[model samples]
Target: MNIVLIGYRGTGKSTVGKVLASRLGRTLVSTDAEIVRRAGQTIPEIVAKLGWDYFRDLESTVCQELAMRDGLIIDTGGGAILRSQNVDSLKKTGTLFWLTASIQSIASRIGGDTQRPSLTGTKSFLEEIQEVLTERTPKYQAAADHVVSTDGQSITQIVDTIQSCL
Candidate 1:
């Protein structure tokens, strides 16, 4: 079975997905990384040039493609759950694991990565994170078959929790 990992930014989706894939002997795929690669630009560059709507469309398309594959550990971007169709597709593909972390924790984890192209000039840093998390919570909850909190958890513990959930 496939394992689709979804969560807020900096929730360790990518890192945990990689670790889970290795432990489970499954291939790993990150929707955000794939979007960046296919767009032939970094995420910031894509958002700057093509716009978030454009990027999100690309993300949905990529999410669908990856969701169809089997025996893969897929890590999706935080906002991937915003669209119900995306959630429907993901649910049909495999088990969904929502990785979660506190807003402060997420901020510390991501830590000024310019490549992320998040709410840099739009709002206060803390407000931006909080806003995004608040908006996405229901969407994430709606999509999850399982939820795993990464806050105060070691990577091994996170991975172990995910395994147990599956």
Candidate 2:
């Protein structure tokens, strides 16, 4: 089985995934990075050029593919849980770990990142984080087998917590 990390942006999924994969001797696969590589564009570019719907379609495909693999530390895109099918697909072969952080912590972590496009273009960074997190919190909770807070936690601590869960 795989250890799948799913959560909002800036929640340390990718970073924690690396440590988890190393500790468990598993392969690391980041859906966002894979999407960028396959699309030949950055996330913002994909959203701008192909539109959010297209990007989401690609994410769905990635989610399906990731679900069929084994012994992987999968770092899912932040919005993967927005689509129920993606969550179900991933849950089939992986233990879902939802890495959570406060809106303030998420803003501090990724507020200035230029590569990611906002889901709600009308809102400010903090507003977007708060709104999106509020809307998606239930879905995340539903999809997770374990939830680990990344707020004020080191990479090792987060990894240790996840390992203990497994």
Q: Which number leads on TM-score?
A: 2
> Candidate 2, residues 1-166: lDDT per residue as tens digits?
9899999989999899998989999999999999999999999999998899999999999999989988899999989999999999999999999999988899899977898988999998888899999999999999999999999899999999999999
Q: What is the lDDT for 100 in model 2? A: 98
Candidate that would win on lDDT? 2
Q: Across residues 47-143, which tens digit of lDDT does each residue of candidate 1 receive?
A: 8888988998999998888878888898998889988878888788789999999988988988877778765468877898988888889888888
- Give the per-residue Cα lDDT of candidate 2 at 75: 97
Ten-residue segment with the worst summed lDDT in candidate 1? 112-121
Stretch of 10 with least lDDT, candidate 2: 110-119
lDDT (0 to 1) per candidate: 0.88, 0.93
In angstroms, the error of model 2 at 34 is: 0.8
Per candidate, the number of residue pairs that clash is 0, 0
lDDT of 2 at 73: 94
